[model samples]
Target chain A: MNEEENRPVRWNLDDNGVAELIMCDRERNNLFTDSFIDAFLGALSEIEKERPICLLISGLPDVFSGGADKETLLDLCDGKIVVKDLEISERLVAAPFPIVSAMQGHAVGGGLVIGLCSDVMVLARESRYGAVFMNLGFTPGMGTTELLPMAFGPFIASEMMLGGRMFRGSELAERGVPVNAIVPKADVYRRARRIALQIADKPVDSVYLLKYTLSSEKRKRLIDARRNEDLMHRITFPMPETRRRISEQYNE
Target chain B: MTKEEVIEVIKRNIVENLDDVEADSIDATKSMKEYGANSLDMIEVVSTSMRELNIKIPRSELAELGNIDELADKFMEYINKG
Candidate 1:
């Protein structure tokens, strides 16, 4: 396969001081495989070095992310890896520059939570987004318990986390999801680029400081939520039923 | 369309969305889980079925459905109303 086909995640810094991290693991539907995680974190590290004023994160045309890989979940269930091993969400929350999540496709479970960590978000009306950990027979993880409520409000977050139902972006807009914009799928990336460019136009220091100030409280809450979620995962992830679900219910 | 037709639509969508599952083998009395349909697969099945049937049901309302039969019944209710 060519490099584009081989690489799952890639990043580049534009002249306008806006960096883009694009996930394009088409064969895997952007699932968080081990290589994908490594590439994602490595790209983030490289992007940070560029000192971009803003960042835009996106995925393939139809899927922002498919969330945790089934094998990863099975490893967690088998006591081979811990929940903290997945650090994408933590890195997103800790990034120095503001992030615009250009989720022009489906974002499920941890995928949606990571997008929720962004300073701003643009979603596609046709794409589905959900906190679907409960449907996989496990408690929410990757700081989702805190981030979902922060992004979608308390009651809607409760319904999503508890029900584990996938909601279309239009439905989420109707239900008052506080994203920056819910536009046509084709417009999602353009809208996000506009927001990112707007942020990039500001003085770099001012934008950085603003992002830091805005996300500080959220970062603190996420730390606590991660701790609590890890505890819950310890209790819930090892269930025989959860293992069964991971083995049988996972489709891709 | 009748309730049986609704069930057929649902079954057709399920076969299209899920892997290795055939409509002939699908048991209406069993949950989609029994047919190895994951949560995402179920969502696709329900969404496509609703699109084909020209019905819209809130996902929350469909969360507690026990089996394909119950799903068909719920779809029938909306179909009758429309």
Candidate 2:
């Protein structure tokens, strides 16, 4: 087995109040296991406590996150973990500071959910990403329904979600995905950090106010979308076809 | 577009976007924020007004105009400059 990074999600706060959350659980492909979820929440608590002016979420050299762990889904079915699912995306989206998602490799499913929650996104020109819940044999668990359409508009969002398409960053740039920049793989972090610094340098009060203003529509819509998705997820997770797909995908 | 035409466009945009504010009560000197125009409403005002008038209002320049009169004046300046 390949060794995972000691810290899957590492949080760093600079003196200027720019915080970076690095995801590096390579062994598990950065899947959302119990450990990852605990670390994720703990890191977010620290970020809230530290009151960073802006946030940057990036991943290891070539891989961002693989998405929700199928193992975790089983636990969810067994009632070991209660899934308040959408709140995860909401927390990042509603964070007081501006967020910049710097994507390297591919961010899919829950990973894509997190990226879309941020205010601005920058993808490595060579990397790929997708909202592939359909491939996982379930309706979208995260608030991707609203986030996808919000980021890419109705027509593109429809094709991506319904078709479960994996999109190259350059292709998305060409298709007019509203990403802030499509930089080289090596430059993803640097570019995102620069943008985070620019946001942090602004008046903190107004920065937060503007985030609240801009995100209000999406935030509200996500709350409603999650309520319906919750029912859909519960219903679909137990279906025979869903079980077959999950088993095949994970080779269970 | 004449200054009168520009003013008409701005006023029409405000009335169309903001439901709470009636067109008759849209005082030119008052801030649009006072008329219950939130950030999204203001964005709509800027976009629709610019599109209708066929003028480029840089996003940064939007912060400088506080009231309907000021916005109308800026639009007139842009039209005259063109």
lDDT of 1 by residue, A100-207 (tens): 999998899878976988999999876788888987789998888888888889999999899787777777888778879999889999999999999999999999
Best by DockQ: 1
**Candidate 2 C-alpha lDDT tens digits along A1-252:** 334348777889998889988887777867887788778877888998887889899886766776788877665555454563455787887788888988976787888888888898889765667777886678887888888898878888888788776666766877888778987788888888899999999887888889889989878978887888888877877777776666666652
Which one is best on lDDT? 1
Q: What is the C-alpha RMSD of each candidate to the true structure, in Å?
A: 8.8, 18.9
Model 1 per-residue lDDT at A64? 95
Candidate 2 chain A, poorest ten consecutive residues by summed lDDT? A77-86
Interface RMSD values for the candidates, listed in order?
11.5, 20.5
The digit string of per-residue lDDT tens for model 2 on B46-71 reads 76788787887566667778788888
Clashing pairs in 1: none
Candidates in order, TM-scores: namely: 0.79, 0.71
lDDT of each: 0.86, 0.78
Cα error, candidate 1, residue A215 (Å): 0.6
